[model samples]
Target: MPDSDKLAIAAHLHVLLRRKTGRVTDTEWMAVNADYAAEVVRFARQRAQEDGVPELADWADRLDHAMHAVAPPAARRPLLDVATQAVRQRAVPAAPEPVPEAPRYVGGIR
Candidate 1:
């Protein structure tokens, strides 16, 4: 799988855990820890399989490690302040758009 896909898997896992447990930082830290990589991958793969997204299972381990390498957002400020800033700035980045097909060449040279 591509690096972007791996990152997206990690991000998706984080979001799911946060929603399920109502914990953010702790959940993120757990997701990123190398020691739990296998377990994390297993859970993610199972979820993916259940969701009929088997492709996600292919790089689950790599995604977990990559996620571990990333630093979770700092929590220096209050949650309310952070949320307010996100609301104001639209902090959540949109997913990248798919690339369009390249034009076909006809002549060898102009």
Candidate 2:
């Protein structure tokens, strides 16, 4: 329960959010992520306090400012791919076995 731990929790929450929902299309995911980020701002302050910091809002803001400093598409493409794939793969059903049809008897008059 330290400042570092609080920051880690915030980072984890973001990653965890990203890793959910297979069919969450990129646009949908992005929108949802934006929402989560907004929510996390509030959560991060609470989390930092839970982790034993006073005035966690200030600490959370600093942590987030550093996090947001990372802003290159190339910087995040791999993470995005991993999260999307993990979700998509989990949602997909396994290939089903084909069932053979029973042989039909020809009419006796045939």
Q: What TM-score does candidate 2 get on C-alpha atoms? A: 0.25
How many angstroms is residue 30 displaced in model 1 relative to the true structure, after the best TM-score fit? 3.1
Q: Which tens-of-lDDT digit does each residue in 52-76 have in candidate 1?
A: 6555565565566665554445725
Best by TM-score: 1
Give the Å shift of residue 76 in candidate 1. Answer: 32
Cα TM-score per model: 0.33, 0.25
* Candidate 2 C-alpha lDDT tens digits along 1-110: 24454456455445433443111123223223545545555665565566554445564464456445545666556878899999999999999999999556666543
The regions of model 1 sitting more than 4 angstroms off are 1-9, 16-27, 55-61, 65-110
lDDT minimum window of 10 residues, candidate 1: 21-30
